[model samples]
Target: MEFRATGADEPANDGRYAWAGTKEGHLFEVDTVELCIVSSRLNVHLSPVVGIYRVGRSMVTLEESGKVLIWGTFDSPDAPQLAGTFKSQRVPDKQNFYAIVGNELWTSSGPVTKPGSSAVSMRSPQIRVYDPTTTGSFSVLPRPMTTPESVGHVGAVTASAIVPSQDHLVYLGHDNGFVSVWDRKTYACLFVQRVSPYMITSLVGVGKNLWAGFRTGLIYVYDVRSEPWTVTKAWKAHKETVLKIVVDPASLWTDETLQVASMGSDMAIHLWDGLLRDDWLDAELNLRQPDFCTFRSIRTLCISWNIDASKPQDLSGTPQNLDFLRDVMLSTESPDIISFGFQEMIDLEDKKLTAKSMLLGKKKGDSKFSDGISSSYRLWHDKLVQAVRLVMPPECPYTVVHVGDMIGLFSCIFVKSSESATLRDVAKITVKTGMGGRHGNKGAILARFVIDDTSLCFINCHLAAGQSHRRQRDHDLVDILEDKSAFSGLGSSSPGAYAPGGDGTTVFDHELCILSGDLNYRIDARRDNVIAASMDGTFETLLPYDQLLKGLATNQTFRLRSFKEPVITFAPTYKYDPGTDSYDSSAKKRIPAWCDRILYRPSDELANSLIPPSGADREDKITPLPQQYRRWEVNVSDHRPISSSFDMQVKSIGAAKRALVWEEIESAWFGVESAMIAEARDYYGGG
Candidate 1:
């Protein structure tokens, strides 16, 4: 029969048996080896058990009503005899939670616990200490220590733990995306750092590392032993919000690798290598040696524009540029892959229409809203496909790989029909960054796929507007990179799971990541001077005033700084008058800036192309070379369209060869580990 387990715990001294509590107030004594219930008792508590803990030799079950029941010793399992019961005295948490730190029970508490102190705001939350050893008696510690009010809000505590390797330290995860460390003895807040914009769901202290699971299904491991801790590793571990994380005790005994298990809201549990040791890195290098790989060179064309809500038919104009799409397509000759990205495809000033359309768009599975909000995307998609058919030869057909739209932003990718079969794990996802991610008026749409064995990703973004919102645009880019929601219909195992040829989710997981859009960064200069500079053809002189360029050159932002952009050879692509060569004359008179642009971050294989390989073919490594970067004067919108072309290398015949290499590496690593473990056990005098 199927059973839903609510709370479970294994004894610290025994590994053969485990205790579990169910939502129906039933308790089960399960055998770890047989995976069957050895004994069970109904009506163990009146309320549903929310947590189960191991205290000394007794097993305690916490109920939803704040009552905890302690059972007698399990040396002789005769249906667990109830030893005692007590109603926990503490402030109730949202999850009705309690944590076991040694023999004491810990719960959350509000601010202002001490008398005669300034009535602090609830922004400063704390953890209450209680002793549950003496049943039927209230034993509490002194005033609970408050967390640091370093920010406007610390948020409620979601999870807490005391480091197993360092018993003097305590770590807590908060809903405000901050993690705080405290001294267990003095209860003094030691360090506070904001790790993510998403809420931290669970925290676990193992060895010298602390693992934090986020609501976005990502995991971050921190090294806490040193002063001012640092993130050791971070990756997507699940498809939904993680509920809890636990480490296998047996794995911890090795003092090297850690085996972590996490449960998420997606109704699934995931196992991960929580901490990567030196041995793991050595194994990884052996598997990805690149000796048996083969590469194919392909040309890619990417075009981006802020269309300003113009329809495709309106793209027709003077004889010199009668059909804008065809001219743009033929500008780059015989590209193997072509991508079109458009921002502000719909009228953003219509707030009511935008809000309603965003709400309805979520329900229709990539369809337009009832009010025709996505009609512009459909028109552009058809127009671009028709343009491709007209420009390319009939023998060399093109196929639409994927099309993704996020309200005012749209992105579509196409490839030569002959290369369509080489695509695998193709996925498209949209991230909303407008109004605190509640609306899609400003956001990003991303498409990722594996071309043969090489992974590539394309991101089309429309960041926050205004000349003074540079920081907001940087934050928007970070949010897009951190999003790890597994693409729908790819199954739970698809994300973050090991597969051949670097298969995974997230933007950075790909070998080549291209970002193109109306990034909205402005030139730090007066409007008249910017317009004069653009008109005088002295655009190269204005590079120092470009916010995006400054950020990239100085490496101001974390992820965006890594990308490289082609040298600007054309004038600014923004703030032009419709159907005219003049700059903006409206009241806003927006300064001319290179807002529409493309940037790319290539993998290390391309970065190390200068060095000769040991034994692998030098041609096997992919090196992306930018050929052209220019802008077109199609003035249907206030912003001119920008395009970039690149000659990118892709893997063609390498999956089978890489898989064979991986098998040999795996076997060698297993043998090495076994011999080392045996030798160490003999030296240390242990089994």
Candidate 2:
């Protein structure tokens, strides 16, 4: 605990720079001088305000969900106007979205380095500036590779701040310690500079001089005006990771009264008069400590299902549109995340379905009717979105953050506006396990995303139909579970979920994996007896009769070692007559069995990792399985939609705690790298 607080607030790029964040999802504007929120608004936005900048006429706020709103700052407590909003690249943005109304600098980081991924390569598209008004954006590429071996992997753009130079240039920082000064007008690389050997954490600029904070507490002063940026001064400033550095943009370097403040993980904020100071530069051995507060860990979890609508023509009937959004919306609070998976969204006869085979055979090339299948998919997706919005309350605004389809299997994910701030590292992968080897009548899609630093995966799979073809169904399961693309990480052009395995590959790699779709497992019992038991509420007695459950348990072929499923409390969900509540009374009197269902399996380490030993025991804090995991009453399609809900624990360790943890990791990383450098020097010097 430091007497002076280590605030995580970031300084604005504007001349009258201010900091804005949220207290309970409402807006808070901090005065740089007072170092406290000056204007706290009354109008509450459920979406936590992750970013805010004061530009020309209004203050622009970027919510966690990537929603950008331009608000009028004239009246301190006035309602901000909603400005143009667009989706930025998905990454674990530690509130890393930096915007200059002149030109916004934000990062869309590469995929999370899975546990066993190879060392990350440098030099890729990581940073960019976009105009909220325009549809296009300019990419800011990093400096050229300087050596065969470099400290940074041209990886994530760790930190960036708008340089208050004459042109209002953007000073971009990378994990690799390289810096680039770029022209906002042409986005041309103006010059490159490497000021530190350690990782660059944050940057601030005043006139011609740039101040950079590193993972080590060292701060570097770079003269940006020099052809090759030159470091004028370097100082060990803090006892921990330097979280942020802010200089008054209006102050000139020559001004003796130039104000600069540095905050660090040390829990102490230091106010330095100017860049050059020999006074107390070393980390203080004994500092006054600030009292720490108890932190709470709890958040929302939701599950939804998409029942078949028969086809596009019948979407509006049965009044066929009973959607699953209502089950997902939390009554006491908003679900931090929601998942909706569709069992079937396309037809076997559709031309797009056969296009893959045709292209490979050279019989017909890709269709020029770019509008054909995609346009239809869009139309269907829009319907789903519109239906979801109808059930949402005005207070809790949510949006479709991700949408993907693998042939007939479709899934969409929605995030509440407030929870979008921490949303990042989203990637999608698809694999076909249907017929003709590569072509499909069945396949699956795995959408992986990171929310609140927790990895979650949703798999929507459709297996081969027909009761006798269980072998093919099992093969499809193996294909989906053992997908080779998952190990490719973000390197492959086609990244998808792999089967559950060690070292975090595929869906098994995520902290939580939610699976839903038509598994097509039938009851091995006589059809008549199965139908009778279903009617008599004797599902328990018929449990053993389920071929899918029994077969999966015994068949090592497709059975993942540690996956789990909820107890089937609902009636059989397959082979029903369209537009009727009755089961298939026709020729294929499908033995009533739970086919369309939802289940979840946690990564082996998730439970142990999330539950701290001092906190509630895993069993006590565990959100109990949802009672509403029953089937939806909608009867538009042959298969009933099953929706289940769960509460995922969100460990919202505040920024202060994160800074402390980062300090440990950074210190360890820096120490190891420094040791490696020394080892290399020794080896080379001896030779």
Candidate 3:
């Protein structure tokens, strides 16, 4: 059933002055480049603004009461003045999108209104187009369908997009699985087509075809090149209502891929390869045949830094998070790749709980609060640049790439600048299984790439907070690992194969997986004893009580029995007061815990005799584990970020490794064979 429609937005325009109107009657103009609000103003219209549009040198804002307010957007010394006010006598639908044509604002404000008649219903077959300069309005009705018996009423128009090739044409999607092409010049419905019975929440026009996303999480491609538009294809795109569908700008000229990206209410964004749908479908069905980009091996040094989106400095006036990250990047030895996972990269401002969180901000100007980059991500980017330029060896300078976030949780990867020439097929995947339902307060981000010839993956996740949410926390962890299976995201399925499970559910699926973030696993120890343990350096005694470590051992989550985690030696990394080593003494008195962590899972075996590094071998100093693992006592956020530096072993991709990866893929379905033992020795030395 369709939801009861509320306020509607006037059709949006993509011109020089991008306009956004809030519910409080405040209008803001934002620059596309700087990605921040450049200027803002309030209007006399007290109703919530549902739509904004840019028409020539003027801006139009649509109010809830079907009122249109136009203001001059001139760059003169004088402030913007109200240009005109008009009413189409039409209300907007929150789920419907409108477009523009020939200086007119087209809106799906509810049912078509007849001249002098005021019956308004979502089931009406007509749409209203309003002229920007005048209150003049006209109706565009859908052509009749099923002979003369029934008019082509397409439920409520939920989504719409401009057809680039034909400016006079627009695509309209309805809640009852109806799609139609409406002609602005002739006021005729070119054709009406019905798909699955689901609401079309979003639509995007790509080339001559139109893409539509439905509330059922399905996607349909309409080939509108010929006289009769045909539904070319469909795919299951998401698990929840598809909120928006956007074409990859790069898809314009590239014949290699007709890629489109989408975000749904399920708290996840999906990247689809439109051209390679068959290959994707096949892999989705047969997970073993996932053609992961095979590489010999890749080594990565991973550090998880919680830059305390709220106050990132310490009492000593040091940007401790930045210092910790920079220092590690400089001192960490030759890792082909480096990744940093960050949590709370922006201060969550719930003013009722406000405590004046400080941030590393830009000068008061265009970049101020620019996409929150000033206070949060930019710090990580700037620190990496400084570390590479000032500290890293001249020959091995690194170039940083931001694996951005859906919420504030983010992850980034740094690779040798020199390797850019040889590195190929880089992919990044970000999934937000938000703990706060669909709001994205918690989730995971991943960056995958092949450096030289080795494939590596870096993962960062923020799970559900608090001790009582243990089950929810573990579920989020398992969700990320499972959702990322079988090259389901980014560039292509890696060319390599994971030896242990042959399944893609875990990062163990990668050659070298370094997963980190604030896991929020609190200890049950008494606060006094926990504080004393930290002060007396007997914190290791609390290791047995750590929830995350214990959870992994008992449950089937991660199922990574072979993955290795370095022993932690630092004090509890949580609930610290900003700028000091003291624990939280606030009213809530949050318990201290090692919430921030870094763990690595190495690939099982590259060759027959490789005998992947494990347990007992570490005592001999030849182990594959990190050389150091400890917490950084930088009292920046309530949680002290931890760092791990290690030199991992990676074999170069060659004939031997290639054969083994393919062999493992086949073995996944066929099961182990006696010949595998003999074949292992031939490819990998039989250790």
Best by TM-score: 1
Clash counts for all predictions: 0, 16, 18
| Shift in Å, residue 430, candidate 3 | 1.8
Rank the candidate models, highest lDDT first: 1, 3, 2
Write the residue-wise lDDT of candidate 2 on 322-382 in tens digits: 4333444443255556677775554555565456433443223632223333444566677
Model 1 earns a TM-score of 0.69
> Top lDDT: which candidate number?
1
- In the range 155-242, model 3's lDDT, one tens digit per residue, is 7777777644455687777776676777767656666666434467888875556788877666666666654344444445677789
Q: Write the per-residue lDDT of candidate 1 for residues 190-272, one digit (tens) a residue.
A: 77766655688999876567888888877777666654455555566777888889866445355543567999999999877
Residue-pair clash count for candidate 3? 18
Query: Of the candidates numbered 1 and 2, which has the greater lDDT value?
Result: 1
C-alpha RMSD between model 2 and the true structure: 24.3
Q: TM-score for all predictions?
A: 0.69, 0.46, 0.48
lDDT of 1: 0.70
